[model samples]
Structures are given as structure tokens and as C-alpha cells.
Target: MSYNSRTIDLILKAQEPNQKQFTTFQQFFKSNNPPPLLFEKNITPKNVKAQRSFSNKTQDSIKETKRKSLSQLKYPEYRMLKIYARIKPGECQLNYDKQSILIETNPYNFDRVFEQSATQGDIFDIVAKQTVDDFLNNINGCLIAYGQTGSGKTFTMFGESSNPGIVLRTFTHLFSRNQETIYVSILEIYKDHVYDLVSGVQDLKLKEDLQLGFYVDGLKKIKVDKLESCQELLQIAEENRHVAETKLNALSSRSHLILTIQMGKTKLHLVDLAGSEKVNKTGAIGETLQEAKKINYSLSCLGHVIQCLSQGQDHIPYRDSKLTKLLMDSLQADCRTSIIVTLSPESKNQDETVSSLKFAQRARFIKKEIRIATQKKTYRDLELEITQLKQELLETKQRMSQTSSVSQFQCRYTTDSEIPCTESLRLTYRSMTNENKENYLPNLKTQENNTQLELENKINQILVELQGLNKEQSLDNVKRQVAKINELTIDMKKTYKVLVSTQGLNNNQLQIQSQFIETQQEQNKQLQKIAEQISSMDSSKPSFNIAINNMIKNLQQQQKQNIEDMQSKLEKVYYDIKKNTTVQDYNLNHLALKLVASPNRQQQQQQQQQIKRSQSKTNINPSVKYLKNKK
Candidate 1:
């Protein structure tokens, strides 16, 4: 019999005490086939007949049941399957349900109906075993638990019993096999920030400088040793996970939790994503609302990634969210991946279940080739070995050359008679030296004296030439100094004349300014007297007073205007002198003109102003002050 039939038979037999009723089950097993059991037979035949008698009731019921089953199959709504054991209000229960596949009770405890339920095994155990086997074989696997709020995805993936979770089981298998070295790294990708959970402990004092794209772009991978270490890392990450209570479920995860296991060249990623739910349904508020938004965004990004992978699009928006980016490698062709979608088995969550199944169905079409990273030795070791070999070769060549030289010396000594005839001629000359000494001595003495005299004459001529060159150098230096002194003296005389001319101009300008100030003071006194006379004659002699006032106003305006014009002219002159002084003849002519013209112009202006003020005073009306007082 098939596993399903055997399990059904076992459950039926356990429900009743009689062995005879179970004979039917045995006969069913012997036939190796069993018809679908009809629960209507358990209902009274009278009641069935009464129901059938009521206007095609039995046919209608059958048609309705068929239609419902067909609709469910045709739509094939997705669901997150959660198999969990929990303690209910009054009893313990193991909950196994799929939202797309309806079940009867709310707190359906497996322990309550352990004998009645299927006996072969819980589906979770079967799936977990298959996943663990895949992990051991170095195939990248994913067990994703996804569902609406309050669905038992977490409980199914992580069992409450001491046997540990699928995560712990997979690690144990890795440790036992010893076939590959396992490195476990844990991180939480929330709101685009990749936080290292293992390194943040105060005692362990792991640094926070863990980069997001340390090992691979858009993937948060950390290198760790051993499965136990990974488990600890996972525990740390669990503690750090962002969770909040919702209306449907307490302690609902607000972020996707991804646990990555790298085994030798293979990587396995297990993701537990937060379920998608309506804000109204979840009753999330404040911070919970923000978390829900992030979760939804990440889940949407994951959907986009799956869709992109299915279509083989060039750009997969993995970087759009932290959760997607962290799975960049796995989502692509770099690893084998499997998605285990979890769902709730409640009619209320039918919509969520349908969406989940549709997403999974689309994900099934994605084709990702398994890419294994090839291992190679590091270059540093190879470079060091090469350097050492080169040094040894050089030393060997040097030793060989030295040995060859010594052998050449020995060979020369061994072949002494092979020396040239010049050595024999030298020996014959040495033997005849005494006889030839007397004959050669006189010629040698004469030749030596001639050579000595020639050497002395050449030395004396060289000394005389050196002395002449030294005297010429000295004379040239003296002439250069005299020329420098003459240039300096000329510059000094010119500078002195310029200074004397500047001093004389300054004295003349001071005298002229003093004289102009005296003349301006006299003009001011005359203007004051004229102003008093105009005020005394103003009322009776309107025309005369108007003329006087006009004259005073005109004189004052002219004086003010002249002073402003003179000041502007002086500024322009000084500015031009400063700017044009560097031109060769411009500075000398500009200085002389300024010194001669400034004083003479000031004296002429003083005389002109004195005459104008005297004339204006003579034209003043005497009665102007008396008229003004009466008005």
C-alpha cells in the first residue's frame, strides 16, 4: 500500500476498539487499493433518505462538492504550510494546516489526535530531513517560511522540542559529516543597513567595521568557522531581529531574517520572511506601521527579483532593498536555491495564501545554475619560493666562476715550459750583464743627463706660463672691481640730486600752502560781514537782498567746488606718479613739473579768491539785517 493509505488505515483502526471492523482495512490493504471512504455512511440511512427525498438534495450536494473541489484545484491558490505543535487553552496540539487547503479546527493539537492523525510522519519532519540531506550534499538550499500574521511558520521551521530547529539540525549534520569546512555568518538587513550580530557583544567586543559588501557586492557575507559558531551567531542575530506584536499574531517579525551557511565552495541560504498583511488586518501602529512598510517593501523587492530571474532580465533590482541585495549571489547563478513557502490554513487568510502560492509558482520557473568557486593557492607563497630559487641560482653561478678561475691558475702552473721565448732572452741578458756593464755605463750616464736637463727646462717653462696666467686673472679682477665702484658712485650722485630736488620742492609747497591758508582766512572774514549786511537789508530791498544772497550762495558753492576739484586733481597726480614712475624719463619729468607747478598755482588761486571775496563784500545791502529783524 502507498504511504498515504497505510497512514489512513492506521488512523481508522486506532479510532475503534473492535478488531473485526479493521478487517475491512486489511482487505483494503490486500487489494493494494482503497476506495475513497464516505463519511455519509456513518450518518443514518433514514436521515440520508429523508434528505434525498427533499427535491434532488443528494444530487445537489454531490454537485456542490464537486464544483467546490474543481474550483479549488483550478485556481490552485498558494498557501504557507506551517506544521507546529503547541499548547492550547486546555490541551497540547500540533498544528498542521495550509490556508489554501482547509482544515477543521483553530487549535488543532496533534497530541490530542496523535493516533487519529497520519502516522507515517509529520510533513515538517519529512521536509526538514530532505533539506538537511541536501545541505550535507553541498547543495545550496532555502527553507522560506512565509504567511499572514499568526500563521505558525516560525514554529514549523523551528520546533519547540529539544530536537532543535532545522537550522540546528543542518548544522549538526555539517559537523558530523566532516567532508567540508563550514563558515557561518549572520547579519540582519533592515532598511539597507547590514548589521553584524556576532561582533557586537561587549565581552567578545567584535568591531562594528563590518562592511556590507565585504565579500561580494550586495551580499553580507562574513567568514566563520564551525557549525557551532554559526549557531551562536544565529542566536545572536535572533536576539537582534526586529519584531513587534500585531493583532493577528504576537511577536510578529518585522524584517526578513536570512541565515547564510557557506560550506567549502557551496552556500546555503535560509530565509524567514515576514508575512504580508493589510494594515487594517494586522492592527499595527506607530513603529509597527513603519516596520510593516519595510517588510512589505522588501517582500515586494524579493518578488521583483524572482520575476527578473524568471525572465532572465539583465538587470535584477537586488540593490533596491537590503534583503534582496544580501541574496545577490544566491539569487543569481552562483548557487543552487530552493524556496519553501509557508502559508496559513484559514479561510480568513485566503487572499494572502493565494498571493503566496502565486509568488511561489512564478519562482518555480526561475533557472539559476549552480556556480562553484574554484579554489586556488594564494600568490604570496608562490612568489616567495620563486625569489628563493633565483637567489640560489645566482650563488651557484658565482661559486662556479670562482672554481673555474682557480682551475685556470693551476693549468698555467702545470704548463710552465709552454711560456713564450721572451722569458729565455731575459735570462741570457742577466747572465751577460757584468761584461756589458762597462760598455753601457758611459752611454747610460750621458743619456740620463740629457733627459734630466730636458725635464728641468720643461718644468721651468710650465711655471712661467702659470705665473703669467695668474697675473692676468688678478688684473682682470682689479679692473672689474674699479668698474663696479664707478657705477656705484654714479648711482649715488644721481640719488643725492633727486633727494635734494625733492626736499626743495617740499619746502616750497609748505610755504605756498601757508600763504593760501592766510588768504582763505581773510576771504572767510569778508564773507561773514557780507552775510550780516544782506540779513539787515532783506525785507525792504527784495532785489538787493536776493542778489546778496545769490552772491554769497554762489561764492560758497564755487569755493566748495574748487576745493573738491583740487583734491581730486592732487589724488590723480599722485596716482599717476606712482604708476608711471618705473618708465625711464617719466618719473624725472613728472617730479619736476609737480614741484614747480603746485606752489605757483596755489599762490595764483589765493590772489584770485581774495579779489572775488572783496568784490562780493562791497556789493552787500546795509539795511538787510534791519528788514530781516522786522519780519
Candidate 2:
């Protein structure tokens, strides 16, 4: 039959009411048989209930991996933070409509909203009481306050003069509760530099150890067994804190301050972060601008770390800033942290308020893996450990000695002369026994003496070489000293030459002055002689008298001219000496002043001697009298 005719007949027969059964041989050719199936198919049952069941299991697995339950742990666990909003007084207010908008913001939600009337005590009671209790119970806890500039963040965390804040209240409570040893360490991170507030170390470092997770390397820890002591330390630290005047806040903190209180193994960290101020809004410039940028950068790094933790990200960059690095242990997966977000009611601070709220919101999702700090071993415990270790060591030694092969193989020592051969050493060691220890000891002593002698000989040789080196060094030192002496001698010779030149100049000046003085005396004597001659002439010779008067006038004119010429000569000599002194590389200005004030001590003495001689030779007054008498 044709393939098309057989297929059409089979289809038509299958549609009939009663189809006859075909025999095995005719089944293939029967026209009433249904068409042959092209391929076999396996059908799966569609059960919506079973599919939903599998989908739920897959979701549960994902959820379990995403976040494990902390409730199952026996140790203390960290709780998610709830927001607390307190609008500061005397500040701008958010409008009713804006308030509604802010409340509607999903991430800006808070557990408690306090109006402008909330007190410091109320805020502390709500935020810090539980943390205090946890701290007392030997659990580490942290309470941090964050907000905008001039939002009263420090005032709220530390309080003003009249109002006491959480820190004081916590101190009072701890003191009242019992006598506990409290160690306080206060530090600040300013402009990316870590500083100790209590110790005044401007630049400090952070160190991490296996036991203490992260600590400031050179931070000062003060032990305060009394409340007064705690107060004193707090006051000192506050005095040391870095504060600056900003346009936004009068006493604006320029750094992040962290105060850690340790009681035995438990600790409590109270951090007050510098307010978040915008560069433009705060009107920050220069140093203030730089500080603002660093503060913002560190806060941003902190925010990034929190965001990563909230979203279950693998990597958290804690090493981005010094503040975050120091706070690594407090912000890690094993800390109990609480953040108090302080806000300003001012509409101008709306952006900062929103930022702070969002920061606290992200922090709410962080579930730190909490565990108690390991306690240090006591004296008794240490002593027990030492005893146990000693016993174990003895046991090990005895076992080693029992195993002859092991002992012999491991036992090896070197002698002064012999080459180090392990096989020979082992043979020698095995040959010695307890009974022969006497003989072995003597041989060991002899070998030790030989080694000592060799060492002594080597040391003597080294000493001799060192002595030779020292002698050579001494000779070199002597040569250096001689060279230095020669250099000093040359300098002294130059100085002496300058002195000789100055003396010669002074002597020339003195000689010139003496000569001028002598000339003046001679002129006086000649004037006396002329006057006497003029007076002695008879009045009858009127012409002769007039001629004599003319002669006297000429002589006086010559004396005036001679004095002027001497003055000119003195000025020339002075200028020449100045130029020569300068060329000789001496300080001529000072020397010139000295010369003008008093030419020279020796020159003055010579001038006085010359004046005495002139006075003795020509008594000018007596000569004038004698000439008048003769006339």
C-alpha cells in the first residue's frame, strides 16, 4: 500500500464507533488503527501547592544566609537603635507642612520625638540608662552623639554649667552603685590627627593587638576610683579639647572626642562627633574650611561603613580615616552601639537634620556580634600554668631520653677543632653513659678549656689589630690637628697685618696734626714780631707805618691760607684711610666712626705732648705783652 493511502485510512477508521482489533502481523497494516505516535512524551503533574512549597524553602535558605539570628547566642547581643529627636530651643522651626513631610520620609523615622521642651535628663534617661546598665554588667557598650553644628550636640551629651548630661549622670550612678575601678581614656581626632586630650599628645597613633582589638598607642589612661577623681579628669580633658569659634557655633568642636571608661574587663565608649557643617553654610574658609572638609570626609567614611554593614556588604573600609580606625572595634560586628542623633529645629539646618537622621537610620539596621572581652589571667592561674608547663616539659624530656635512637639522632654538638659531623657526634654521645659520666665530664672540661684558650687567642689577635688601627687613627688625628693649627696661624697673621696697616695710618694722621699745630705756633710768634716792629717805628715816617700795617695784613692772610690748606690735607688723608680700610676687607664704617669720635689713644697722647712743648717754647700771652711794652 502507498504511505499516504495507509495514513488516511487509519485516521478514518479511528473515528468510527467500534474499531476491530488487528492481529500482530496485520496491526501495522490495519486501517482502523490509530495513527502511530511520532515520539513518546513523559508528562509531569502540575501541582501549584508543591511548587509553592519549593519556592518558600528557597526563600528561607536565602533569608537564613542573609542574616543569622543573634538571639541564639549565649553572650550579650547588640540591639538595633531607635531614633530620638529633640528640637533645640531658640532655633528656627520647621513649618507644619514641612514637619509632616519630614515625618513622612521613610528613613527619617524615630522611636521618640521630643519637642523643644525636652530636658537633658529626659534625653539621657531614654538613651543612656540601658547602656550604663550593660556597662556595669561587664558588657562593652558605646553611646555616640551626632548632629549639625550649633545643634547643642555637646551640650546634650556633656551638658552646660547648670544642667548635667549623661556623662555626669552615668558617673554618679556608677559611683552610687558600688566601688568599681574605673580607668578613663579621652582622646580626639582633629583634622585627621589623633590627639590625647588627657595627656596633651598632639599626634598619637592607633595600635591593634590580639587581645585588645584597637587602642590609641600613647593614650593616657587615668584611674578614677572616686567620683571626684572622675570629675577632675573630665574637667582636664575638657580643658584640653580643641574648640574654635565658627559662624554657626560659638564654641564649635573642631574634632571628634572619644571618652572610654573601663571597669575591669568591661568598657564604655562615649563619642561626641564634631557637628556636620556645610562649607558654604558655616562660611568656613582657610583653616576652618580644611577642618570642615576633613570632618565631613571622616563622617562620610563612617556613613559608608555603616551602609555596607546594613546592606550586608563583604568589605567595610575602616582604615579610611584615623577616627574610623580608632573606632573599629566599637563599630565592628561584635559591639553594642547606640547613636543619639541631635537635631536643630532651624529650617536652615533641615538638610543636616535629614542627613543625621538617615545616618542613625542606617545604624539601626546594624546587628553587632557581641561577645564579652576576655579577662586577664590572675596570679594563681599563671602560677598553675607555669607548673603544668614545667611538668609537661619534664615529661617530654624523659620520653626523649627513653627513645635511644631519637635521642642519639637529635643529639649533636660541635667542638673547637672538629668539623661538625652529626654521625660522629651521635656516636660519641651514645658512647657516654651515667657510669662513665665522671670520665666524660673531665674530657668535656678539657675540651672546654681548649675552646676557651682558642677564643682568648682570637680575642688577643683582634685586640692587637684594633691597637694598630687606633695608632693609625691617632696619627691621622694629629695631622688633622696640625692642619687646623696652621689654618688658625694663617688667619692670625692676616689679622696682624691689618693691625699694622691701621697703626701706620694712625701714625701718619698724628704726624700731620703735630705739624699743623707747630705751624700755628710759628705764625703767632711772627705776628708778635711784626706788631713790635710796627709799633717801634716813629710816627714821623707815616708812609713806613702804613707799609708796616700792609705787611702785617699780608702775614695774617698767609696764616689763614696755611690753616685752610692743613684742613684740606686732613680731609684727604681721612678719605684715603677709609678707602684703604675698606679694600682690606675690614669693617670701615665702624672704624670710621671710631676715628671721628677720637682719632687714636696714642695720637691723643702725642698731641698733648706736642701742645705742652709748644706752650713751653712760646708763651703767646707773655710775648704779646712784651711786644706792647716795647712799642
Candidate 3:
């Protein structure tokens, strides 16, 4: 049979009564059925009862076994409900049933219900208002709408034609508040690819270098100035969303969408994940099948991560999938986070509802410190303001100098110089007119006054230029200091790298030294063993003499060789120490000396040599031996 046929048969057999027997039958059939048995066509009720008695007992035993298993089973601590239905019109309703506006809808009614309710102040308005208030208060905030596909997740998040979406409402509120700085970056993670919906060409051609990982440890942030721009960006992203036809709905999102809003220092991440669907229900084919598989794998990994976290397992498998890994920081208890779970209330979607509910329930147990970190303006803005002030001051100073120069020129002609010349002076000048002073007096006075005024203006201009030069010089000094600081920073980095390398080298050297010490210890043990062997030999007569002689000779040779080697190593060490007597080198020398000493052998050799010398002296005397024999 074909592989597909075999797979189908296996599935069918798995569902059969007497599963073990069915499996056996399947295996036998696969093996071409080596033997077959035919049973009796009919039996009496009494006979049947007798036959079934044994089976009944077995069934009872099996039931008891099943009961034990049931007893051992643990109920889920949290339930995750995954909504998987579409929002069709007329399937849901909206009413102010609860204190807050109540939206009663299944997946089918989501879009229509959201349209009608959003017109009357929907959940988006509530969340947006809260976010705006938070923004104004210098607190960081986030509002995320989460739900399955075709469940009006998109519509609720971003409403239909008559109503604006959460994103639009948020910006509208933000603009209205006008109290914070906002930047928005819209992106879609489709097939593990991040695309910039805004700032790219209108042709939907994604820029090659514009891709960003959806879950980056350090994501670049965008700054938004106004709500209109944010809304425009959102519209662009919506256009870029990857949509495809599925069995359930057309325009089904094929990728996860993330819209990030950065307000000053705080970041708000609004994520709309693609609805998860079972492959059999999706009826996905070809590339869609592959895409579905990847989606399911990632989603499953996310589920596992959630499960592990709920269980307080130390090993959360975030690294198993990109999605989980990216969410690591957000999921951490330190990060202030809130999850809004949207669900389809349809009874037909019991499984999806349960899954989504369970997910929400698990999320409820996750205790996070919900602190809204308000973004504080950095020094850069202050610096810019200071620069602008300086420029204005300089301009004012220039204008003041020009005004002073003009006033000085006007003053030269005013009051004192403008006074009418005295008649007496005119007469005197007339008397001396022929003698050369009188004829040019008015011209000389005018020239002198002009020269004086010109001098004063030059002095004032010089002072202004000097002041400007001083300012320039001061600026240059500041620049020099900044450069010096940069150089120092570079040097510090270099020093840090050197320190790190040195530390690594030190650790390695320590390890090597430890190993060397261990080897020396082993050698010392061996040498002790050898010494014990030599001592044992000394206790034996003939063997002791021969062994002692051989050992003495070997020792003499070895001592000579070792002395030479030591001298060579010492000379090398001496030179090395002279060149660079680091603490490490000194330690090495001491260790080397400890290895060369053999205390036991040296003492024994000295004793033996002394005895031999004494014996030789006694033998030379000769009379001693004879006298000793007579006694």
C-alpha cells in the first residue's frame, strides 16, 4: 500500500475497538496476513454470556485501572483559550450590561459588533484614554488587543469604515493631550521576516536592508511627533500586512503584526498575532501548508513557554522559538505588562473558547510589577537649547555694538560740536586769516572731530572683535576637552580589554601551575616509593651491596647530569628574571628547587662515605687488628 494509504489505515486502526488486536491485525495485514481465522457465525445467549463473563471481568479490571489513572491525573493550573472563529454580522450584540460597556460577541460578530460599539465609545476608547492619561502623567503604558483571526481582533484593534481602531484612537488621544513625545514604528513579522511598512516605496517592495527581527533584544525605536503621522504609519502597515484566502475567511492575516510606540523613555508595544488554525480546519495547501506548520510550531513553542512559566519551571524553553525568546524581557516579572484577551463566545467554538480562556487564566496568575516608567528628556535637549541661547546672545551682542558705533558717530556731531561758533573766535580767525590758521580752522576742527569719532568707533569694534575671538577660543578649548575625553574613553576601553586578556592569561597560568604541582607531587610520591625500595634492599646483604653500589654510581651520574641541567635552567631563569622579574617567574624558580632535592639518599651516602674513610685508616695501622684478635 502507498504511504498515504498506510498512514490513513494506521489512523483508522488507532480509533478501532480492541486497539491492540487492531494493531496486530494491521501489522499482519501489512505482512500480507500469514494466517487467518474464521469464527462461528452465531451463538446462544447463555453461551454468549459465558464467553462474555471473562471479557466482562477484564473490562471491569480495565475500568478500575482507568479509575486509578483518573485519580493520578492533575488538572491544569491555568486554562488557555484560543479563539478560531470569524465575526459574521448579526451574530453578536453590544450593550452597557456591565458597569462598563459590554461587548457580547463570537468570532463571527466581532467586526459588526465593534463597528456599532466603537461608535458608542468602545474598549479602545477606554484603553486609549487610560494610555493618554498615563502618557500625560509621565508614566509608560501599553494597551494590546489580542485575539484569534477573523474574530474582529483587527476590527476591534482597528475598527471598520464607520469607526476608528484602537491605534487611531490612541494617537487621537495622544495628540489631544499634547503633553508627551511620541514615535511610532509599524512592522509585520511574516514568515519570520520583519518589514517596514512606512518610509518604503509605495510599490510594496520591501527594502532589502530594512528588515528587523520582531523580537530583538535591543530594538531601534521610532519617535512620533503627532497622532496624524502615527495614523498614517498605521495605515501604511495595514496595507503591508500579509493576507491570504483561507477556508474560514478571505483576507486572513498570514503573519504577526507589531506596532511599537515610543513615548519619551517608555515604550508601548502593541502586538496583533495572526490567528492560529488547525491545518485540517484551515485546509491549507502547498506553501500555505508550510507556512501553517511554521506558525503552529512557533505558537506551540509559545504555549510551552507559557506552560513552563505557569509551572514555575526553571528551564523555560524560550530559546526553542524566536517568538518566545523575543518576549523574554516582557514576560519577566520585572517588566510591567498587561494582557487583554479577546475571545469568541460562540458555543460552536467550545475548544477555541476554552483555549483562549485558559491562556487568559494563566496570564492572570502572572504577577508583574506594573510600573509605568515615564520618559525623562535627556541632556541633549538642554544642550540644544543652550546652543540656541548662545547664538541669540551673540547676535544681540553684535547688534548692540553696531548701535553703539552709530550713537558715537551721532554724538560727535551733537550738542558740543553742533554749538554755533563764537563771534570772538570768528573775529580772531579773521585777523589771522592771511597768516594761515584762520582760513582752514573750520576744516581742521571738522577733520579732528571726524578723526576722534573714527578712533572711538575703531576701539569699540576692536573690543567687540576681541570678545568674539575670546568666545571662539573658549569654544575651541571646549572642543579640545571633548576630544580629550573621547581619547580617554578609547584608552579606557583598550585598558579594559587588556585587563580582561591579562585575567584570562592569569587563570590559564594558574591552571598550568596547578597541573605542574600535581605532577611534581606524583613524582615525589614515586621518589618516596623508590627510596623505600632502596631501604628494603639495604636490609638484604648481597643484593644490598650490589644495589647500593649500582645506585651510588647511578646517583653520582644523575647528580652530575642534574647539576648541569639545574645550572643551565638556573642561568636561563636568572637571565629571564633579570629581564623581567615578574612575581610569577620568582614562584617558578622556588618550585623548581623544591623538585631537585632528595633528602633520604643524600644522608645515606654521607654515612657510607664516612664509614669507608674510617675503615681505611684502621686497616693502614695493622697493629689494631692483631691486638683485637689477642684480646
Candidate 4:
């Protein structure tokens, strides 16, 4: 009479078929032969219907837990999509007099709206800063730039050296923290087919798991290190991305490029979508015509998915297009999504602008359910990953053995000394993995930046009063970059002189001004030494000047208070001595002259002449030179 545990569990689950678990065992007893579970027995329900039911559940509010591990938030709430609008600077081309103009009088608002004058820093600080902070806690995030063709979508996502875009800015911010071990994969969806940008692998496969969502298969993953390395990688991806000349744009992106940043189990996606356009306006023909059709179709599908999610449809057609399917997790209730919709004020594209606004408005209503289970992998998936990693390790060893020419000394046009030779004598410092000058760098950079830490400690020692100043909040624009010798020296000199004044005395507060001014001439020499040390070690840190500036400010205030206190104490001591003592004076008091007071005046003159200059101030004074103890 042994009962199988599986049967008992299934019977219990069948009692409350709709619930996550059985509510009562009494229903199991009523049926001696209970039916098996409808789909499959799984710890996490895999049925599409079950997933829908959970998604539809109305929660009162986002619930917070008392405690959790791994990530700070185990159950981050399914938040609404964070959407923004960026208005590119241009004259209103839409004719106000024309009745046929497509423009909304009362347009939909968003979480944040950027004006035409907004800088790249402004966009990042408001949108991506908090997400990056959360990323360190292991929460996944996604940033998507959506807009019409030539509407500054790519420009907003990736900017120039003078003003870095979100992608470059993100890399700088992420690496500056020195926390996560991040890897990168770049891919583009062109003509509804995925292609790896880095490895130039064409037509990669899209794999989907019931719970884990969709991911591209066979894409090469590159390890990311310094900010320069990220820039190089991004350059390669951009070069590989599909682009063409159009009537409206000189260089137009024809594909949707997605950069996936992998850190352990967490992933952050940076998607730059091709702008939507009117085929008539674009004058797209031939191959460009076909690309336009696919791009428009994909964007429309995205809009449709948003429409469905807003209406709470039972079957959202996520599988309708590759673009939607690939970005499913980002749009759905799992990954945190932030959308920057770029808009052109031109009258020609007013219709597209209105449509984009509507799409974003609907997208704002979609909420992502942040369950405790951020780990998208299942046991079977882990097993497969293990197998894959082992295969990768095997392949690595095979490649290492095969790449003997690369690992060992090989033929070159010239020797290391620029001598004409066929073979190089130098051993390869790089392993099978790709490397540059940075690879041979110190293992110390593997952790935190020692140079930054040491600089901070030195600053902390110098300005002890400002120890409470938040280390996290680095004062911006207060001082120039440490690398900028001229600017930094000027900024530091001004900040340093705040404590000094003009009155002349060695220790006098007023005289301190001249001392500081004199030192200003040599300021460049000292600044160069500091900048060289800091920049040579880690050029990523620009806070050195800012920290020093703040330190100087605090030190100046502290110096002023100290000078005042010292002056007050000296004055008080002088007055106390004056009140406690007495003094008397006598005209020439020579020992011989005291006895011959009635003698001639010549004797008095002789006594006066004999008097020492030290005693000339006063012949007799009752100043206490020493105090003798009377026992």
C-alpha cells in the first residue's frame, strides 16, 4: 500500500488546479484516483495559461520584503516602462494655418522630457544613473532609443568625443565603479535576420525558453575592461551596423542594433533602433526600399505589442516580428526598460511624430512584474550551459594548440629593433584571448583603483574637517580635470588663496596671501607631478581636481578659525600678565653711585654711561624673571 509522492502531489495540485500550490489535502482524499496535472509537473509553472493568469493578478501595490540575499531586492516590483521624449532643435515646419497638419494639441507627457538644448550629461543623469546604481545590486536594465529616421536617435544613444552619448557614458560610468566583471555582445537585426556585429557571424539563430525569454544563439561574447577598450568595440559594431544614404539623412541606420552587456546572470541591453520614415519622403529605392519595408514593419509590430499590453490582451502577438521577440523581456514585466523617443519638429514628419507619441503613451501603461526569481536559468539550462562551457574550454585548448604561430614567435617584415628580419625573437605576452597594451597591465587593476584610494586618503589627511563630505557625491565642474595642467593649476591656486590675506608677518593671516601668490608661479610644476601620477595610473578618474578643490575650501575655513583662535589666546595671555604684575623705574642706579648720591654730577653721568642697552629700557622694573619655591 505504498503511495507514489508524485501521484499524491498531482492529486493535491489538481484540487486547486488554478493555484500555485494545493490549498487542501482533503480534496485529494475524496478522489482515490485523481487526474494528473494538465501540462507538466514543474516547481515553476510552465504553461502559457498559468503565466497569463499570474500576469493578470491585480496587486494592491508594489510589495517590499524585510530581507533578501544575492541581490538587494529579491522582488523588485514590476514598474511601468520609463519613457522619455527628446525634442530636437528646429523651427516648427508644421503649418499652423493648414487644417490637414497632423499634430496633437494636447500631446501625451512622459516620465521626463528633454528640450532641444539638453546636453548628453543631462539625459544620462536623469535616465540612466539610477539604473546603473541598481545594476550593481544585480538588477537587469535596458535602454532603447526609438524615433523617426534622422531624428537623432543614434546621436542620442551614441554621441561624439566632445559630448559622449549614453552608450559611451554608460561604459565610463560602469567601469569607473570597478565592481562587476562585464562581458559584451553586439548584434543587429536586419531584414528580420540576426547577425553578430563583432565576430561578423551572419544569420545567427534565435533561441527562446518558456521562462527565460528570447536570446540570440552563437553570438561572440567579448570581455570588456577599460573605457578605451569599450570604445574600440563599439566602433567595430557601429562600422558593421547596416547604414545607407537617404533623401533625409546622409547616413541612415537600416538595422536595429542591440548591445547586450552580460555580468554574471544579469544583462543590460542598449538598443538603438532604426528611425521610422515615409517611403515617399525617404525616396528609398532598390535594396534601400526593401530595408525600409522591414524596418517599418518591425516598428509597427512594436507599437502593436504596446497596444496589446496596454489593453491587457490575453494573447499578445510577441511572435509577430523578430524585433518584438528579441526585445520581449525588455518590454515585458521582468527587465527594467527606459525608452528615449527622439522627435523631429519638421512638418513633413509630423504624422510620424504623433504616432510615436501615441506608441510611447501606451507603453507607459505596461508594468513589469519583478519576481524574486531574477535567475532566468533553470536546472536543465544550467546543465546545458555547463556542457557548453566545457565545450568552450575544450575548444579553447584546441585553438591554443592550433594557434602556435600566434602564441609563439612568428615571421614579421621587421624585427623588434626595426632591423630587417623574417622571424621575431620576442615571446607573445597575449594568450589565445585578444589583448593590447592594457593586457600586460598590473593585476592590481583587477580590483579597485589603488591610485584613487591613495589620493582620497591623502586628501582626507589634508582636509580632516571635511571627512563628513559624502564620498559618493563628486563635486562637478568645481575644478578642471587633473590632466588639464593649466586649468587645474588656475582652479587650485584660487581655491588655495581663499585662506590667505595681505597683512605682512611670517605667521600673520594677512601675510599668508603673499605666500600663496608667490607659490602660484610654481603651481604648474606641482600640478604636473600630481596629474602625471594620477592620470598615468588611472585616467578614468576625473575627481582628483574636484576632491582637491573641496579639500582646499574646507582647509581654508578651518585655517581661518585656527588663526582667529590663536590670536585671541595670545591677546588674553598678554592682558592677564599685565593685570597680575607691577613695575617701577629709577634714573641710573649704579652700586657705587647709590653710596655717592651727594657726590659730583660727573659720577651720575659715569653711572648712566655704564648702563647696558639691554637695561636701558627701564633702570628698575618689578618684572618676575623667575619664581623660587620656598620649602
RMSD of each: 41.6, 37.0, 39.2, 30.0
Using lDDT, rank the candidates from best to worst: 2, 4, 1, 3
For candidate 2, give the lDDT: 0.61
Tens digits of per-residue lDDT for model 1 on 1-631? 3435545544443233256656765565457563234221221222323323432444444544553343334222222122222211222222444222223332222111212132223433554455555555444555666556565555544544364556766666667654444666655555545555555422111122232232432334556556656666667777777777788878777766667777555567666677787888988788888778877888888888888877888888877876776666556543445455555545566677557656765676676553332222233433454455455445434433432343342334333233221232222222233445334334333433454454455445444444344334433443343344334333323332343343333453344445444445645555555545544442323375356446545555655554444334433443444453444333333333233233366764554454344435544222222212422
lDDT against the true structure, each candidate: 0.49, 0.61, 0.48, 0.61
Q: Across residues 68-174, which tens digit of lDDT does each residue of candidate 4 receive?
A: 24544455454636888887788765322211223556547678778778889999998887776566556678999999999898889888768889999888889
Task: Kindly give the stretch of ten consecutive residues in candidate 3 with the minimal lDDT sum.
Answer: 35-44
* Candidate 2 lDDT by residue in tens digits, 1-631: 3235544444333322134422321364345343332111101122223333443454454444332222222563435344466677876554323122253335355566666788888887877887787666555678787888888779877897579787888888788864556889988999988899988988887788876877788788898878888788878888999888998998999999999998766778888899888989889999999999999999998888889888877888887887777777778644567777777877777778778878877876776664543343443444554465455445444433433442232334233223122232223333334454344534443443454454455445444444344334433443443344334333323322333344454666657656655664665566556545544544334475466446645654665566455545655564655566533223332232222223257864554454344445544323222222433
Error of 2 at 156 (Å): 1.3
Q: Which structure is stronger by TM-score: 2 or 3?
A: 2
lDDT winner between 2 and 3, please give it: 2
Model 2 Cα displacement at 262 (Å)?
0.7
Over 504-539, each residue of candidate 3 has an lDDT whose tens digit, in order, gives 334433443344344335434544554555534423
> Measured by TM-score, how close is model 4 to the native structure?
0.48
For model 1, what is the alpha-carbon lDDT of residue 156?
44
Report the CA-based lDDT of candidate 1 relative to the real structure.
Answer: 0.49
Query: Residue 164 deviation, candidate 4, in Å?
Result: 1.6
Q: What is the lDDT of candidate 3?
A: 0.48
